[model samples]
Target: MTYLGEIHSRLLDHRPIIQGETRYFVKEFEEKRGLREVRVLENLKNVIQETNEQILPKCTETMQDYLSQTLQRLQAASHLVYKLQQKEQEQRKLNNQHLLISEKQRITQWEDFMTEQHNKQAAVDEEHRKATERLKEQYAEMEKDLAKFSSF
Candidate 1:
């Protein structure tokens, strides 16, 4: 193939990769779909490392390879970051709910304890009043007996 034909062929091959990046970046901007964890990005990382290794020594090759790889890496990072943020937010919400429930339970238990204490105090007070009344009756009877004996 002629030198110009070689360049044309390489450009044609790179067109798809560049377009793939463009598509994802555009999708990110549009926010048409919510982030979904389709798969682990271990493979993407491996691909980036491989692309970097190969593209660095051969600068004459298509520059589009680096552009494509860079964009893909950026998108993967963004997706992972978004996913982690969501998980953290959900955990915080659950923690708040748990704390609220525990607080309510503690309040109810305290109220119950207070009611029991009040009931016990009322019973003690009634018993003391009854005992005082009995003592007063006994003193009155003793006084009457003493007065009768003295008169005789």
Candidate 2:
């Protein structure tokens, strides 16, 4: 119903007899003039429909291209995220390995220091035992000499 109204309006707008008539009764128009206006409106409608048909495919193709490009970008972003996650995992593993190596080295150094201290303590104990034995021998010789002098 709206389409028919639009067609009628267009016909009235295009008619030469009705161009400047603001107050003329629409029912008073001659049948031949009305027919001519209707034909012109029908022709205009046909031209508009043909133009829309010609442009519809290009619009649809443009929309499809935009969607395709958007999908490609999303796929690329997804791949980048995956690669970043993998790299993070690799870095975490390397850090753990570095920590382990440092801990092992620290333990080894502590063991070496403990062994060196033990060796030094053992040498000091041996030297102290030798000095005590020499002191006991000297005291025994002095006691014998003093006894002989008293007898005489």
Candidate 3:
């Protein structure tokens, strides 16, 4: 045989071996790829679980603290409003009392003025009565003198 024919025959003999090697390598690569995918999934699951265990609680606690502080601030504001209402109420009461006192003072002054006017009227009436009595006595004396002259 020629050298080319010998080479072709040797190639035909090695074909089955090469095909078998190719199939085996493909199977190994698929298995390694599947294992790597499974490991990646497992690592992802672990990371998710860790986040749940560590970060979630911290976030929840921080949110709770913020809510608690908000509640306290609301309560403080409510208390301040209550105190302001109470102060306003007291001020109103004081104002009413002052108004009442002023009214009483005004009434007292009115009563004093009325009493002074009554006293002045009484003094004028007494003087008029005394003057009328003195005029009657003088008229009686003049009539008595006229009667004596007519008899003479």
Best by TM-score: 1
Candidate order by TM-score, decreasing, is: 1, 2, 3
**Candidate ordering by lDDT (highest first):** 3, 2, 1
Clashing pairs in 2: none
Q: Which ten residues in a row have the lowest lDDT in candidate 2?
A: 22-31
lDDT of 2: 0.84
Q: What lDDT tens digits, residue by residue, belong to model 1 across residues 7-113?
A: 88777768778899999988885575333322335667777888789866576355778888989999999999999999999999999999999999999999999
For model 1, the local distance difference test gives 0.83
- Candidate 2: lDDT of 107? 95
Extract clashing residue pairs from model 3: none
Highest lDDT, which number? 3
Cα lDDT of model 2 by residue, 1-152, tens digit: 99999988778656656555633556445543688888889999998897788767788888999999999999999999999999999999999999999999999999999998898888888888887787777777777888888789
Clashes of each: 0, 0, 0
The lDDT values for all models are 0.83, 0.84, 0.90
Which 10 consecutive positions of candidate 1 have the poorest summed lDDT?
32-41
**Relative to the unseen true structure, what is the Cα RMSD of model 1?**
25.8
Candidate 3 similarity to native, TM-score: 0.43
C-alpha lDDT (0 to 100) for residue 118 of candidate 3: 88
Question: Higher lDDT: candidate 1 or 2?
Answer: 2
Better of 1 and 3 by lDDT: 3
